[model samples]
Target: MQQGGNPNDIFIKINALLEEAKPRFSEECCIYKVPNNIRKLNEDAYTPQVVSIGPFHHANQNLQKMEDQKRLYCRQFIERSETKNLESLVSCVQEMEEEVRSCYSDDIKLSKEEHVMLILVDSCFILEFLLRFYFLVTRGDDSILLPEQLLVHIRNDLLLVENQVPFFVLDKLYYLSFPSTLNGEDLHNHPPLLSLTCYILPGFMISEDNFVLLSVSSDVDFGRIAHFVDLTRKLLLKSSKLFQLSTSDCSREAQVTHIYSASELNELGVKFEVNKNTECLLDITLSGHTLRIPFIRVHDWTELVLRNLLAFEQCHCIHESYLTDYTLFLDFLINTDKDVDLLIKKGIIENWLGDSNAVAKMFNGLAANTVTPDFNVQYSNIFKDLNAFCAHPWNKKVATLKRDYCNTPWKTVASIAAIFLLILTIIQTIFSILQVVH
Candidate 1:
């Protein structure tokens, strides 16, 4: 059989073709490993080629595969391109290159021609993985990504600032030698790294008592701040789901905890941003797990919060009370206007007025009784470490009752029944004594 001709030799054929293409674009070509199940794999593999070869290689094996699978539905474009439309694509590439230069500083800039080339290169390099991952993870159904064209356009952009070597080159060189922020903590020398790291282990307040230390460093940025809010929302949702799952199989507590840990990693996108710090550490007392995020560099605040909202909807522990409160808090944070009436009118925020009112009445009765309640005891132990909440004397009382109320509802019921029975027996005995005397 010819080297790559057999039906069973698909991978081999692709590899052979790559070997042949390597010398043609020797400086740019690099071998890559990609997922077969994800459709973006082929496009991703071919993106680099676009930068070097122009649009002429549209028939390259990967693009052909995409067309064959009807993923892109580009038969008409291919047919038209074969005859009439080369200049439009070139013009599109030119326009895309101009758009990229806007991202960089304007003071010490190159001429327009040089500018477009460098920006295209930078765009291609930075966006290769990001665009592919987006398509693979978010919207891979009816495929509309033009991976090869995008790569060429981005490559042209990068080449616009031709004098400046590609960023990844410098990033690789200085990254390892740079001072260690945390043994495994440093994300990037760039601005976004610090913020990205924050999302990996965003801090959270547990129950009404514990404050889990999600990270050690505290120089957080907007990205991390956004991530923290998003993570809190997702965790609460997950916690609610765990609660429901617990009602069915109490034995699944460990499983529930594991699911929380795993979901936290998967939903947070920290693994992609900060892969080194994603591992979980044991929390023996709580029978739970913890992951630490080091916040050093940060940006992209709004993105983080929006991401959190999406994750919150996916979490299982979402409770009605918590969701209602969370929704209000998120609205308060994101809404620009300071009008409470407007917020209520928009129907975006549900008033917690009713719950707060009930709580006030219960506390008022406690205050009137003038009784001193216990000052130490944790209900769920989840929030026990949160010194901010737990240090208050009033909080201690609430914590104590909450624990008792949650842990032994059946026992409390049984005690009330016993007391009623004893009272009834005494009344009967008194009646019998009266009869005997008569």
Candidate 2:
């Protein structure tokens, strides 16, 4: 107690500070900084390699080279959009500045003008890029398709959880850029922004078959989508029936204690099969002795995509946790490179990453810092069924026999021959005893 100030004045100042410190979390805030614990595992996965989309990495000096490209795209968007001018696009973003600001979890340090400008430039760049990709795919235009690697990087950067603008911003800009009538009627009648986005990001699709399903799926409600990452997730969920199935018997409080690895399960007579019918990667199912997993192609981008999706789930959608659950489910099944090998043999995993060990490590590392609800886990039923199947006495005995003597054909033959010789000796001894008695 320094004597000069009144205690009540000091307490009043402290209360003012506490009021300022109150949490500013908004219901609309969806984009988030990747949790430090998760980011520390592989920072590169959650970071933008080529370009920064929003305020998160906008100031990164490394990404400054793409700033010119973004401005050029913004210019092109204005020129080709045939809207009044740049003012029109600026006005659009300016109107939504507050809403846009609320979408970010962290306090954006940029001034209001700077923040609005950032969104405008980044949003236009994305729209222009997606439009270029759409023309390249639809109209055989190869102008922007050159240097394919850069395109891939930008596509990936757009999907990062931190590198995002609200999807509605893009939607508004798209409509403004290409009003009802502009040029060729055939190409002018382009698919909606969501559909175009799906088309541009084919790497995230479960399969080539699902490409059309995702592009044309009417079930995806565009209004609910928060950003590009969320759009991709929603499209995937639209095609999946994993949670729609009834799990009435499974307790909501059930927690997955343990599950046998792929190799161990195989030894216990559990078969692995690729489910060819579904386009949803998360639509894995276990039928009796067979486990059906969708074919997943694991290339360089796979880990990056998965890590960002996991981060997004951890940050914004902890309650939903569909991607998190699916990832952890895979993590449970894949304990070692041998598990990766088993899945590869079953055609369940297409390991374009070349090393099975890397794939196994990637899956194993993805669940780090993730929390799955002990109650109502999406894979709780699967976990229970798999444990029950492996626990059966018959399965355990079969596994033991397979491990001990019947693993190889030569060993199996040798065991059978030994059994036959034992039976013959026993019979011979009995006959000798009977003859002696007679």
Q: Estimate each model's TM-score.
A: 0.22, 0.90
Best lDDT among the predictions, by candidate number: 2
Q: Candidate 1: deviation at residue 168, Å? A: 26
On the 0 to 100 scale, the lDDT of residue 332 in model 1 is 22
Model 2: lDDT of residue 173: 83
- Candidate lDDT scores, in order, read 0.31, 0.81
In model 2, state the lDDT of residue 392. 96
Q: Which stretches of candidate 1 lie over 4 Å from their true place?
A: 1-86, 93-100, 103-111, 118-402, 413-417, 420-438
Instruction: Please give the TM-score that candidate 2 achieves against the real structure.
Output: 0.90
Residue 428, candidate 1: Cα error in Å is: 3.9
Report the poorest 10 consecutive residues by lDDT, candidate 1: 253-262
Candidate that would win on TM-score: 2
Tens digits of lDDT, candidate 2, 70-94 = 9887777777775647888888899
